[model samples]
Target: MASTGERDGTGGTDGAETAAGTAAAPAERKASWRLVGPGIVVAATGVGAGDLVATLVAGSRFGYTLLWAAVVGCLVKIALAEATGRWHLATGRTIFDGWRSLGAWTTAYFAVYVTVWGFVYGAAAMSSSALPLVALFPGALGLKTWAILCGLAGLAFVWFNRYAVVEKIMMVFVGVMFVVVLYVAVRVTPHLGDAVTGLLPVLPDGSLLYTLGLVGGVGGTITMAAYGYWVNAKGWTDSGWMRMMRLDNRVAYLTTGVFVVAMLIVGAELLHAAGTAIGSGDQGLLDLGRILEERFGAVTAKLFLIGFLAASFSSLVGVWHGVSLLFADFVERTRAARAQGTGGEPPVLEVARGQRERSWPFRGYLLWLTFPPMGLLWLDQPFGLVIAYGVLGAFFMPFLAGTLLWLLNSGRTPRQWRNGPLSNVMLAAAGLLFVVLCVQQVRELPW
Candidate 1:
């Protein structure tokens, strides 16, 4: 295998020509459709039920006035994803390692956020995944039972299978959900003039915040940060894989962009025209399904529900698996430090050898996300937990963008792979937009 540094063209102990010579043989191997794996899964996983609801509500409330926002969101995600993949390929380091370079502060923040975020997210995700199932198969199983089953099934799927198998499963769900959503959008047949106007790039009165939210919300989550790990897992760790990575990122976000645009069309033509509003929670999706039944008939409603179930369940599994990897990586790093005695001689050799080994803390955090949060499904989540989730969630996008900017521009990466002027501009703009949204989130907090 070509070392990551050589593949990235980041001249180190090895030179570029030698790296290229090693990678050239693999480069000649014909690329297959099957290689487009984890990117699609990560993208599909990132755009969950909450994202669907958010986009739908935006369309219903603002019509296609925010279509541009959705497009912008896709662009921003592409930039972020590409940067992340670049870091992995270039530095031969996972995103966790990249973040650690920024400072201990970054790692510390992520440590707390991952734990708190996973616990709450697990229950919420499983419950949301369960709602459509409960609606479809009433009395067959209680909601909590279904939720637990979904969680366990997801856990099992990831625990046993490797990356390629999991990617195939997620891609199937992505296809199902994508087709259903596109079909619904086609059924609605939104106004061309209104959609064209929405593309004109102007935020209307009283719509600035909604525009920002729509743009920022487009197919994003902590899992977006997980893209690098997925790429690493796929064995795409060199600059030779750069073209493939870019292609993967492009296709994933293009699909996601289309999905969001379709939802916007549904919102604009169906809900907005009918003066209908989706409710605020996962239940809101159930309410929308009923409305679809009334207007379009039972088949259409069922299809929509299927799409919802796929979206929710796929995301449930996606987060369960992807975040677990991240948690594991975080814990492994922490444990290595502890094992070496802080002020004593470093255990650099042990840490290096065990860098990829799974740690107890990783599995512990996974269980933490999967089990303890089951109680919260029955009761109100603690105020502190909710507040922390909200705050950390808001900060993630900016944190991701800013860190990518810093890393990509740093001496750590090869100059050829560093952010070009155009990429930097897009990333900087994304960073600014996310910063503004983060401020809004903080300002709007109840406390």
Candidate 2:
């Protein structure tokens, strides 16, 4: 594949540097399609079942009124992902290492967040992924059994495979789910005027919170922090790949934007037009499938359910793998005495030690995500645990945005590859929005 600067014609400073750096490298002249990997897979995996349900709920409730918020969500994610990939490409450091540079506070925050978040998120993700499957194949394996099985399966997949293999699997599911969901939207034949109107920025009555939620939600999640890991895993080290990393980030989120817009179209045209109400949980999706069957046909409903399962399952795999790596990085860093003492560990520590190469934390977290969560699938998730999860989860996006802006623009990165004016502005806007959402979440929490 050609470097991003050559393809896009945007020869920024970083682009020129990358071009110069790769000047001596062999030019294989491979097709661009062959270069598709981690970025697209990560983007697809990041938009899990919750994102889809949230978008559908927004559409069902507000029609296309919040379409701009969804678009904003996509743009914010692009900025975040680009920063992450750029950090890895420019500094040859993962996000975990980048965070450590800011201060011990960042590492401390992540240590606590990843442990608790992983526990609660494991059960939630498994249960959500299992819902559509259970609906389609009731009593085949029981809900909890299926959830545990799904988690284990994901663990196994990520444990044995390298980045390229994982990317291929994710891409297949992305293709399947995208086609299925987009086809459903096309079948709805939505209103062009209302969708166009949604593209404009307007806040309707009693929709302040919902609008904010849509803007902040869309495809935002902890996996946004995992982009650096994906970039590293794709062999995109050094400043030479910075331009490609940015392009990868942009393309990933652009695809995500289209996927989300299509879903909003379905919600606006199908459920909103009929005045139908979806339920409050994953089962609500099954309810949607039934509605689709009644209105359109059984095939349509089955296809939709299949797409839902694919989305949820792909996210299950992603969280099981991506978050586990984050957890491993956190553990390895925090346990290092130098890291604890200095308020930041050396990036060379991560590169040289390669603790993840032979670490139990990596596999242990994977097992934790697969097996322990099954109990929660059987029993109710504790309210206290849920509250903690909510609070910590709410803080991650803002934390990520804030740190990216601080690090990328600071002396830690090469000045030539640091955040330009546009990137800084976008990151600032994302940080502000996420801060507002975090505050709203904290205030509304049941303390």
Candidate 3:
């Protein structure tokens, strides 16, 4: 692939000079078809075991009635990830850099949010990943032991590897996830006629909140913003890679749709048809595994459990690497400004160097995500912390959507790359949808 500056005819920003007085390196070229890894990583990360269980529960409750919501959710995420990639390529800036340009308040919100979010998320991810492992090898380790081990393993893998290695490993796990979920989907004996009819946008009676949840929660989170960082990590730093990046983003959500819809199929065909209800949370998956074992034998249940581990573990390491890269960039630019005694923006190249996966801040956050959260695994998660996590998490999607609206439509973006009417409409829809969801989440939180 040719660099963005070379292909798009837009040169780098004039003042983006490194401390050594060199211009930022131009974006490089690559085949758009071949640039598929970053999206895979994002997709795999976003749809962890929670997403699957949620889809399963939806299917069990409403029996394929909300299948359309899953598709819409993927479309919403596609729009968000595409706009993020466009901003990166068109402006040759990191998402943080753009957020910082918005104001110091943006930085402040992100700093506190990331720190608190990572603390809670790391333990949750490890335990989720360890669930299937313990199920498959029950006598081998306890849940807390397996969770701690999973956390350490993720930290080690991310700390030792770069973006390329991380992408490759995520893809392998995604393969396992696809095969097992798809196999169960095919075996579920779906009602083809009802599924076809579900393509229509009908909200079943009394299913408004559940339908909205499915539509808004399909395959998104802060990991959506991490897509741009992954694009840069893959060395696709210019408008030249925009087409490929969009394609990759679409592929990510498409894969996510498949994972989600397959779980829906399992829920509808197995649980709904049998009048069985699974419990909530990751344990719901364990409940499903037991049912699968009784019906299809131990081999099938083991395979699904293995797939579950792959899905959760992919999120663990992906977040370990992707979010850490974001944090490291923040540290690098902040310290660079302080050291220069000028509050001016740090050069793009300066932030680029800090992208090294082995950087100190990267490893520090990795350790933070790995070790501290283990406390929550042993002692129950504190009530206040869970409430705070929910509050911060609720606003993040809107924060991303509203900020993208500002960044993409403003002078910050190139004229050719600004959001078209359709993009704006979709983003506006996403912003509104998430705002409602955020309010509901806040109200539902037991303060």
Each model's Cα RMSD: 4.1, 5.7, 4.2
lDDT agreement with native, every candidate: 0.79, 0.77, 0.83
Residue 418 local lDDT, model 2: 82
Clashing pairs in 1: 7-239
Question: Which has the better TM-score: candidate 2, or candidate 3?
Answer: 3
TM-scores for every predicted model: 0.90, 0.89, 0.92
lDDT of 3 at 137: 94
Clashing pairs in 3: 1-29, 1-30, 2-29, 3-27, 4-240
lDDT of 2 by residue, 184-296 (tens): 99999988898999999988887888788777786788888887777676666556666667677777788888888888888888888889888876777788899889989
- In terms of lDDT, model 1 sits at 0.79
User: What tens-digit string does per-residue lDDT give for candidate 1 at 322-367?
Assistant: 7877777776655655675546433332222223324456457667
Give the C-alpha miss distance for residue 285 in model 1, angstroms: 1.3
Put down candidate 3 lDDT per residue, 267-297, tens digits, no spaces. Answer: 9999988999988889999999999999999
Best by lDDT: 3
